[model samples]
Target: MNDDEKTRDYNKAVAAFAKRYLPYKQPLLKTIENFSPELADVVIRHGLYEIWEEMTPLLSYRDKEIATLAALITDNTVMKEITAHTENCLIQGMSKKEVLEILTVLTLYIGVPKIINVMDAVKQAFENYDQHIKNKG
Candidate 1:
């Protein structure tokens, strides 16, 4: 495929990735796409596909997400990432309870106050996942 065709393929992958993992952020992503089309490509490529290809042998995506969630909860990242990461954790192969357990484990180190906020994000992630399932049905 030519560069244009490769870009098109990557764009399709981005759309599907957003639809499946970011079900609630389509509008936000659309706005970003409207503003910076190149960003979505670079982010998707680096954030997910590249990581999976290069790092999965060292850490499975689900494990990476567990660590990602811990970092996000610790304020190592934008707290807003929790919801999406939580869902991604699930999609990558965590059960809901396992995802919740992540938060549970973090509660000791991060404290209840911070954990409460993380819980809210996780709740939203679960809700979004449910909505996606319902819509699929």
Candidate 2:
């Protein structure tokens, strides 16, 4: 495909993926798109659509989410991503109990300081998810 065609295809793919997996993050996505449309396309197509979409028998979506959450804590990423992934974890059938267990284990490896940040994000994610369900009903 030509440059324009490739950009269009990537944009389309990003939109479809976001609609399915990132419906609640429109404002953040739009901000990135506004700052640098090309960067937004790269992020959506590569990060969310490609790597996140892979779910093999060896690494199911739930496992991937758990891993992602733990890695995010270790890397000290933005709170919004942590919150978003926490929501995705619940959507993928990860119980709150399991999330707690994972976080507890991660504290040893990622340290208490990082877990502090992660816990706040986790709390926000739960609150947001609860509110979202309430609004839907």
Candidate 3:
């Protein structure tokens, strides 16, 4: 494909992927698009569509969400992302018990403080998800 065609195809794929996976309808990408289209392009095209969707053969969406949640918990620096992935986990059919168990077990490896931080974020994420469903209804 020509460069223009490749770019168009990539943008289309990113849009499709982001529509499905992005949190809060992707306000993050939308906000950045105005001032930083390139960064937004990278986030959607490479980060979400390429890295995430292209891994479906090896990892299911639920597995990816679980892994992402675990990493976010360990990092404990981006509460918003942690919460977003927490909601994504639930949306992917991960039960509250399963999520809690995962976090609880992580306390063994990643320590209590980081796990505690994510625990709070998880709870809030659940609450927010519930509210979102209600509002949508």
Q: Report residue 112 deviation for candidate 1 (angstroms).
A: 1.9
Residue-wise C-alpha lDDT for candidate 2, range 1-137, written one tens digit per residue: 47786566566656655544445776676787889978976776556645655323477777878888878768887887788888878877888888888888988887888888778889988887788768878
1 versus 2: better lDDT goes to? 2
Off by over 4 Å in 3: 1-23
Q: Candidate 1: global Cα-lDDT?
A: 0.72
Ordered by lDDT, highest first, the candidates read 3, 2, 1
- In terms of lDDT, the poorest run of 10 residues in model 3 is 16-25
Candidate 3 global TM-score: 0.83
TM-score of each: 0.71, 0.78, 0.83
lDDT of 3 by residue, 54-127 (tens): 65659988898899989988888999889888888887888888989998899899999888777778888888
- Kindly report which residue stretches of model 1 are placed more than 4 angstroms away from their true locations once superposed: 1-22, 26-30, 76-79
Pairwise lDDT winner, candidates 2 and 3 = 3
Error of 1 at 117 (Å): 1.8
The global C-alpha lDDT for each of the candidates, from Candidate 1 onward, is 0.72, 0.74, 0.78
Superposition TM-score, candidate 2 onto the true structure = 0.78
lDDT of 1 at 93: 74
